[model samples]
Target: MTTKTFLKAGLIGALFSAVAAHSALAFPANMTTDGPTNPPVGHYEFCRSLPQECGSNPGSAAPGVLTREGWKKILEVNYEINQAVTPMTDKEIYGVEEHWAYPDKVGDCEDYVLLKRKRLIETGFSPADLLITVVLQPNGDGHAVLTVRTDRGDFVLDNMRNKVLLWSETEYTYLKRQSEQNSGRWVKLQDGRTVAVGSVSQ
Candidate 1:
C-alpha cells in the first residue's frame, strides 16, 4: 500500500485495539428512538427531490456489524469528506435558509451529512445503518450529522470534526434522525433535552 494508506491502516488498527480494550467503557450500543416524529423541512424537500433514495427497507433495519473493514471505511469517508468540502451555509450558497443536498465542494452541515451517507452507502454500507441525524449544539444552534449504526455503537460523522465519535460522546443534544426502517420517516430521540425547532446551518 501507499504510505498514506499504510498510515491510515495503522491508525484504524490502533482504534480497533483501543475499542476492544475498553469495550466496557463504550457508550450505549445504540440511541433509543422514542416514536415517529416530523421530518425536518430540509430533509423533506431532499426526499421529495430524491424519492428513490427515501424508500423503506424493513429487512435492513438492524444495525450493521462494525468489522475492521467497515470501521476503516467509515473513518476514511469521514476524514476525506471533511477535508474536501468547504463549509458554507444554504443562505450563502443557494440564497435559502435551509436546503439539504449532496455537496459538490461547498455546502452546509446537512449537505456534509448527505454526502457522507452517499459515500458510505457506495462503499457497501446499508442505507438503514446510515442515518441523517438532527442535533442541537451547546450553543443551541441546529446541526446535522451522519449517524452510523453499528454493532459496536452509533458513531457520528460530523463536518464540524473529522474524528468519528460515539453519539453519546458528542456534546450535542440529539433531536431526531431518519428511521432505520424508512428513510423518508423520522423518529424522535430520548435525549431528554427540550426539543427546539430551528434551522440547521453552518
Candidate 2:
C-alpha cells in the first residue's frame, strides 16, 4: 500500500480490524424479529456488498426513481447497511475515538458510514450534506463515524446503534471527514476544524 494509505490504515486500526468481538452481536430491542422477517436484517441481507444489491451507480437514478422524502423513508427501515443499531443498554455507542469498543462486530465503521451516505444520495439529498467522518472516540483512538449535515444540524448514523444523534452531541474528537459530493466528490475534514473539503470530479 502507498504511504498515505498505510498511514490511514494505521490511524484507523480500530475500524479495519476484524469483525465483532463476541460470538453474537446484539442490536436494540427495536431491531428484534418476531419471525424470519425483521426491519434492518431483512433489507440488509440484500446488500452483502453494496454494488451487488444496490448496483454500481454510486448516486445516479435516471429521472424518476425515488423522491427525496421517499428516500428518507427507505433509509429508516434498513439502517444496517449504513447505520448502527441502537444499543440495548446505556454503554454509549460512540466511545473515545474508536470505531467500536470490540472487534467482534460484523461490519466495519466505514461500511456503516458509506451505506447511509449511499442511501441518502439514492433518495435525493444533496451529496454535500452527507459526510463520512473520522474521529477519536472519547477513548482518544482512531475511529470512523458518519456525520449527516442536515437542516436539523449534523446527525450521526452509527453502526453502534440505530439512534441518529446530533453531531455536537456525538461527543467525539473530530479527526477527518470524507463525503460523496454529488457523485465522485470526496471531502476530508480534519478534527477541531471544518474545511471546505472536496476532490475534483473524476
Candidate 3:
C-alpha cells in the first residue's frame, strides 16, 4: 500500500492494541489467576449432575457492571445458600482431597460456593461474574468462597457469613480462583500467596 495508507493502518492497529491493554489491565492484578489448570474433580461431578450449569452460556455474564439489583441478588443468594446447606467437613462427608460440589443436605465451604453459583446462574446472573475463589484464612487454613465480579468491585459470598463483603474486606488471604474466561481452569492469585486447608472452619 502507499505510505499514507501504511501509516493510517499503523495508527488503527495501535489504537486497538491500547484498548486491549486497557481491558487486560482492568482486571485487577490481584484478580487475574497465576495460570490455568484442570477443573477440580468435584466440579466434574457437579457438571455430570447439572450439565446445563457447567455448559457454556455465551454472553451470560453482565457487562462487568454491578447494579443496585445485582448487589441485592448477591446478598440474597449468599444468605439463602448459607442457610440451606448444612456445613460439614469433607472428611465427614467425602473424606480426603478437597471435594468441591453443590451442597444438598450437607457440604463444606466449596460446596456452598458451588450451590451459590448454580442458583445465581439460574437466577439469570452471569456465570462469568460468579467465580469460585480459594483463599488462605487468617488462621492459615485454606477456604473456598464465591467471588462475584462486578463494576462495583469483587465481592465475596461466604458460607461463614450471610452478609456479603468485598473480597478485600474479608480476613482471608487471596490465593487462586477459577478463570472468568473458562470455568474448568483455575489460576493462582498472586506470588507468595498461600494458605493451609483446615477442615471447614465456618
Q: Once superposed on the true structure, which residue ranges of model 3 sit more than 4 Å away at CA?
A: 1-30, 38-41, 44-57, 60-63, 95-97, 191-202
Compared with the true structure, all predictions reach lDDT values of 0.82, 0.41, 0.66
Better of 2 and 3 by TM-score: 3
Arranged by TM-score, best first: 1, 3, 2
lDDT of 3 by residue, 1-202 (tens): 3333433443324323433444444334225455655555666666677676665436634536666556556666777677778999988998866566667889998888988888887877888778888777777777888998876557788999765665655678776677776676565665233342322322
Winning candidate number (TM-score): 1
Clashing pairs in 1: none
TM-score of each: 0.88, 0.44, 0.70
**What ranking of all candidate models by lDDT puts the best one first?**
1, 3, 2
The total of clashing pairs for model 1 equals: 0
Error of 2 at 55 (Å): 18
Between the candidate structures 1 and 3, which one is better when assessed by TM-score? Answer: 1
CA shift of 99, model 2, Å: 14
On residues 22-107, what C-alpha lDDT tens digit does candidate 2 reach at each position? 12323221111111111122123334433243322344222223234443443362354532333322123443222322222334
